[model samples]
Target: MTAPALIRGYEVVIGLETHAQLSTASKIFSGASTRFGAEPNTQACPVDLALPGTLPVINRGAVERAIRFGLAVGAKVAPLSIFARKNYFYPDLPKGYQISQYEIPVVQGGMVHFFVGDQAKTVHLTRAHLEEDAGKSMHEGLETPGCSGIDLNRAGTPLLEIVTEPDMRSAAEAVAYAKTLHGLVVWLGICDGNMQEGSFRCDANVSVRKPGAPYGTRREIKNLNSFRFLQMAIEAEVHWQIEQLEDGGKIQQATVLFDPNANGGRGATRMMRTKEDAHDYRYFPDPDLPPLVISPAWVDSVRAAMPELPGAMAERFVTADGLPEYDATMVTQSLAFARYYEAARDASQAPKLVANWLMGEVSKRLNAEDRDIADAPVAPATLAALIGRVQDGTVSNNAAKQVFDALWTGEGRDVDAIIEAKGLKQMNDTGALEKIVDEVIAANAKSVEEYKSGKDKAFNALVGQVMKASKGKANPAQAGELLKARLA
Candidate 1:
C-alpha cells in the first residue's frame, strides 16, 4: 500500500503537435477573411468549402512565414514539399479531405529549449509544416432543443503544424514548452497566440512506457487551449492511462479530448484506428502554387527584424536590474509587463526601489483587479512620482499607501496635487514627536514596566502614540529610531 506512481515504473514520454493559426488578413486557400466570430459560413469561399472544380492556391505569405519560423528555430526549410489530402469525415470539415503537407514539410527538425522550474529541458522538433484549419462546431445548441451550429470562419485559415519529439517527462515540462512556443510565435509575429480564440491550439501525444520496453500506445488529446488546462489534461490523461494498464487493460492508440467540466477526466471519446503508416492522402506537388524557395538573404533579414524574445529579455532584466529570478520571471511573463517595469524604473528616482514597489504593491493591485499591465490605471511617471515622495520622506509609508489607493481608484487627480490637497506630509520633527513619545511612556506605565522587565510591549505602544499624535503622518522608520534613542 505505497503511494501509486502516475508514471509507475514506466517512463513518461510526451510529444506535442501544435497548430498555430498564422496572423494574416486572408485565408490560406481563399480570399475569404480570416477574422473570428463572423456569421456562420460568412468567411467561407468556394475553395474553402471544397466545391467541385475549386483549386487550392497556397498563400505566399503563409509559406514565407513557415520558413521564417524554421529559420528562427535553426531548422532547415525544405525547398520541395508536397501538399496532400488528409481524408476525414466530420461536420466541421467542409471538404472530405484537408490539404496539408505530409512526407515533405516546409520546415524539418528544430529544438525548443524551455524551463521546467529552474532547469531547462529541450523538446526536439520532428517537423513543422503548413496546413489549413477546419471550421468549428458548436455543441451547445445540439444538447438543447436546437440544431447544431457550424462556424466556417476558422476554416481555410493558415495553420502551422509544429510536431515535437517525445522529450517531455512531466506535465509541467509540457506546459513550459507550450508557453515558450507560444511566446516565440508571438514574438516572431507569425501568429497572434490567442489561445482563447483557438488561434494557437495544442494536441499532446502522451505515452507511458515501462523501463527498457517498447513505447506504449498513446491517446492524442486534441485542442487544449489554456496552459492550465494543458497541464491538467496531461496529468489526468497520463495517470488515467497508467491506471488502465495497471488494471490489466490495453492502452488504446486513438485521439482523446479534454473537458474541464468533466469529473476528474471523465470525458468521453470515440474510437479511431491510429495510423502508423504515412496516410495515403494522394500527396502531389502543388500545381497551383509554385515551389517556395527561400534564400539566405531573406532568412537573415527576417532574423534581423525579430524582436527581443521573452527568454532574452528575462536574462537581461536579472542582470541589468539586479532582480531575483522569480521577480524577473513575474515581470517578463508578458511583453507589456516588461515594458511597464522599464518605464516605471526609468521614471523613478530610485530604480530598485521602483522595482520593489512594482513587484509588491503594483502586482498586488493588478492581481486583485485581474487587470493586465497594459491596462494599468496609474501611469509610469505618476507612479514613480508617488514612490519618490515616500522615499524622500515627504510622505509616510502609511500615507503613501493611502495615496496609492487613491491613485489605483483614479481619485485625487494627480500625485503632487493629491498629496498637497490631502495634507499627507510626514512629520519627522523631533521636537513634536518626542513630546508625544514621552506622553505615551507616561500613559502606558504597566507596558513600560513590562519593557523595563525585558519585554517589547512598551515599544509598540510608544510608536502607536507617536503615529496617532502626528495624525498618522510620522515616518514609521524615523519614529522608531527616535523612540529608541529617547528610551536609551
Candidate 2:
C-alpha cells in the first residue's frame, strides 16, 4: 500500500475511540435495565439517578465481558484497576461526575489487524476502559424547538471504551479498523454490534500534517454510528482541515459532529465544543467502589470457555478447505456466515464452488432483500444440493441459476424438484449431445468454415446455436468441448 494522495501536502491521521455497549442485562453500577427503546427515564433507578444515599456497585458480568475482550485482543488484563470520577456537567449526566477509568484501565496494549483490500494493516490499541453510558438528550424534531428533553433510560448502561493509537493514515484504513473491531466484539458475544440502535459508536480524532511533521492539532468527531458515516465524516473533515490550512487558518482542537444531511447529503462537520483534556475532567478515584481485582484463575476459566477466534477460523478454512485467504476471510466475517459456509462446504466438498456461489449469488440476494445469512430463504443444505447438480453436470451453470432462483423464491423445496419442474436438467446423454453438435456444425457451414479458418468467435457462435437447439439445457462447457472437437 502506497500512501493516499496528499491533501494539500498534508497527511490525514486518525485515531478512534469506540464505545461498545456491553450485552449485560443490567447497568454497570445499578440494577436498572440496559435495554434500549424504553420510555424516558423509565429504566433509571435510585443509583442511576444519583440520588443521595445510593452508592455505585460494579456489575460482575460487565467486568467479565471486558476481560473476555482483553483476552480476544491479546491485551493485558490488569490484575487490579481503579474507577475514577470524571467530573463533568451535562443534563444527560444524572451524576455530576461520570465514573470511568483513567490512570489505570482494565485492558491495555493490543493491536487490531485487518485488511484494506488485499493489503494487511494493524492498528495498535491504547487502552479499553470500562465506563457507564450517559443518558440521551433529544432535541431534534421537538415540539419546543429550543428546548431539549433528557432520556435517562440509557443512563448507567455498561460500556467498554476501546481507544486506538494514531495508526490510521486515511479514512479507508480507519473505517476498516472500525469494522474489524465491530465484528470481533460481536463475534465474542460481548456486544450486539447494532450500530443503528447505538450498541456501538465511534469517535474519531482527526488531524492533518505535512509528511514527517509532528502530529497536527486534532479535532474529535463524536458519535459516528455507521461505517458509511464514519468514512464520510473522516473524508469531509480531512478536506475541510486541508482547505482551512490553505486559506491560512489554524486547525482548532475541538469536538465536532458530522451532519449527514448537511450540504445536501455531501456531508459536513461542525464544531460542537472545544475539546476537553483529561485534566479538564478533574479526574479522581471514586470512593464508593473498591478496586476491581481479577484473579489469574478467573481469567483462565474465561479463556477456557472462549470460542475459536475469527482469524484462527479463517486460517483453518484456508488450510482445511483449500480456500484462498480472501475467500476464507470473507466466509469468517461473522460467526453465522462462517457456520453457513462451513456447512455448505462440508456438504458440497467443493470449496471453491461453494465460496463463489456464497460470495456471489447468495450474498447479492441477501443484500437485495436486506436479510442476513441466518435468515436466508435458501438454507445451506439446499444450496449444497444446487451446487451438487452443477458439479455433476446435471445442469448447466445457466440452468443451475434457474434452479437457485426457484429455490430462493420458494417455488420448490428440493433442488431436484425445482430442476424437474422447470425442465432445467441438462442434456447429459453423450449420443444426444453429439447429435446436436453435428446438426449445428452442418446447419452453419459459414460459421464452421470460419472456425476452421481459426475464428474463435465463430466457434462460440456454433456452440450458442447448439445451446439454442437444446433450449439452454446443454452443459455449456461440455458443448464447447464437443464443438472444438468437431472443428478440430
Which one is best on TM-score? 2
**Per-prediction TM-score to the true structure, in the order listed:** 0.78, 0.91
Best candidate, lDDT: 2
lDDT for each residue of candidate 2 in 217-292, tens digit (9 for 90 to 100):
9999999998889999999999999999999999989999999998889799999999999999999999999999
lDDT of 2: 0.92
What lDDT score is found at residue 61 in candidate 1? 83
- Candidate 1's residue-wise lDDT over 426-473, tens digit each? 886778877777887778778767766777767787688778877898
Q: Per-residue lDDT for 105 in model 2?
A: 100
Model 1's TM-score against the true structure: 0.78
Residue 72 of model 1, lDDT score:
68
Please identify model 1 stretches exceeding 4 Å from their true place: 1-13, 111-124, 138-150, 208-216, 245-248, 264-290, 315-330, 354-370, 394-406, 411-413, 416-427, 431-488
